[model samples]
Target: MTENTQHDVIRRNPLLEAAQEEMRKFERRENEFRRKDREERAAELQLPLAEIKVH
Candidate 1:
């Protein structure tokens, strides 16, 4: 194995790993929020309303 490859594998160093995890979690949450917003908008658009006449 090359020295560079070994170095890359051993370079996690705790802080970097935590940062990467946080970033991944943030991205996942953002995607979920976007998907939910899209679904809600679609549902709203598809809703039907009826009007009543008053005397």
Candidate 2:
């Protein structure tokens, strides 16, 4: 077998495939959550509150 074929076999391992898929899912969720939090913080900061009126 050639060197390229050997490398392809290793890349096709089931355990490696599962681990890579899990990492992809985790990264996607992390990015989504971070983006949402950033948007919320930006919105909060943009709000204008002139004075605090206590009753």
What would the TM-scores of all predictions be?
Answer: 0.59, 0.61
**Which tens-of-lDDT digit does each residue in 1-55 have in candidate 1?**
6998878767856768899999999999999998677667757887322332312
Worst 10 residues of 2 by lDDT: 46-55
Off by over 4 Å in 1: 1-12, 47-55
Superposition error at 35 for model 2 (Å): 0.4
CA-RMSD of model 2 = 9.9
- Distance from true position, residue 14, model 2, in Å? 0.4
Give the local distance difference test score of model 1: 0.74
Residue 16: error of model 1 in Å? 0.9
Specify the highest-lDDT model's number.
2
Candidate 1 lands at a TM-score of 0.59
lDDT score at residue 53, model 2, on the 0-100 scale: 38
Model 2: lDDT of residue 13: 93
**In model 2, what lDDT does residue 23 have?**
100
Could you say which candidate leads in TM-score? 2
* Stretches > 4 Å off in candidate 2: 1-12, 47-55
Q: Compared to the true structure, candidate 2 yields what TM-score?
A: 0.61
